[model samples]
Target: MSRLFRDVEGGPLCPQGSVVCIGAFDGLHLGHRALVRHAVARAQALGVPAVAVSFEPLPREFFGKAAPPPRLTLPRAKVEGLLALGVDHVGLLRFNARLAAISAEQFVREVLIARLQACEVWVGPEFRFGKGRAGDIATLQALGVELGYTADEIAPVLLDSERVSSTRIRAALSAGDFANAARLLGRPYAIGGHVIHGQHLGRTLGFPTANLRFGGKVPALSGIYATRVHGVGARAWPSVSSFGTRPTVDGVEPLLEAHLFDFDGDLYGRRIEVEFVAKLRDEEKFPDLPTLVAQMHRDATEARRLLMNEQQRATA
Candidate 1:
């Protein structure tokens, strides 16, 4: 009955049969949404639950030891995003050494066949899985004949003739091209998480902030951003946010700190989403406290100006 799961060795989750889609699904962007929604439609027609199978500590992340690479979405956000797309169940399979050693055939037999009892399986183009990333659409189709299921690969979603992909989104984010990123993602770029206590350095500097941590994952983008915080009230509150380690304070952990304008409330333990509107500046270390505080004031003023303009245009 649980909507979320994190392991591959569990008992059957969809005993009655299900439609399954598999992907990394880090960003839950247009392509991922399309694949998941398609599988959900198939499940509805078949009167079975829809299951989305993805991996935590994604294969690439696991294998890329030189540098783990940046992540656009974390585990929690990935699950919530998939569920919001109408997937009845989510499998954020733990991708450790054990899971990595299993053959593609073993994966399909254990996860797709035995666990999910999938009657129909869907995936994005060029989808691959299993040890050494050996599985592919051909592998799935061939296995489907032997395992009593059907396999399919959805056409790659495209924008302006280029494939809409997580790679593309990451590039846009790196360039601070959020408008293009939003176009590919099908929504504004935002990160949602429960607020946690920080060093209270912002408060000490007279710019109190609500902080969110990145759970040790490297973020795709970092810097000062003009943003809007959602879920506190009727509307998205105007805010300025910084996503990065506070080098100026000798901080090591990556954190997202938002300073909501003209707002006074406790956000600790409250989950909220911060939507990025524009990149104000890159996070940098200042010489001293006074200089850092002065820059913070300027950054805040710039953020306010940007958000107000955005609000005016939205209402217009």
Candidate 2:
């Protein structure tokens, strides 16, 4: 069973000598996966539990308000994916102002040493932490010696001659390039949320969609997509999704609205997972409701065809 631990302070929970990796792990993309794999391997070799320690309200989100870009994965989805990757435990640390003020030495000494007792630590080459981002691989290595442990930096994972990173993934998603993003993530780009009541405009247009109001940071993409909707998971239902500010409806907040083909029955408050399969088109303001409805029909057709082919390919 995978354990999910939340760290409210700049402290750890596991006992000492545990093998661990630490990072924001926002997307848990291929690069992050490589580091986690290394940590897990080290844990297996040392006969200790493998743990991944990450932060909530990520330091960047808390500190970089001016440049807050959309996140790739929410905490819940990231935790689910990490568990699927065979991680034994996950730590979701709360990154408040006080926790952010801890010095690197104190983070290592009090948290990593006293609480976690980590015998070995894995981090990425560009990873940095502690008060004002003062910590680096070199500092961690030096501290490892004094603290009686080992530290290693994992190199970046690459795809198409570019380093796989959360930034790159977000860019791909914004550009509506699901294939490229999936190549980097080793899975489909997904948005998970609960179904919510909307203005029922889609029903008037012959498409009764399940509107999803996400809980955490939204993704960068805003457009029509060919998607797969999963809930009970018997099979991924073909879907046409629109992610945007709904300008036509005068809606200001972004929403993920998915119209699952051949699906009926109330889904209000039900959790749904929408996986991006292909970008159908960029969102635009239509001159009239009739025009928008026509475009939606075309999008639904394209989404169905793409999903059918994708399912066949998977079966083959």
Candidate that scores best on TM-score:
1
The lowest-lDDT stretch of 10 consecutive residues in candidate 1 is 1-10
Tens-place lDDT digits, model 1, residues 265-287: 88999999999899999999998
- Taking the tens digit of each residue's C-alpha lDDT, what string does model 2 give over 153-228? 8877778787888888888888888888888888888888788999999999999998976554656788999998
Question: After superposition on all CA atoms, what RMSD does each candidate show versus the true structure?
Answer: 1.1, 2.3
* Backbone steric clashes in candidate 1, count: 0
Model 2 alpha-carbon drift over 4 Å, by segment: 8-12, 309-316
The per-candidate count of clashes, in order, stands at 0, 2
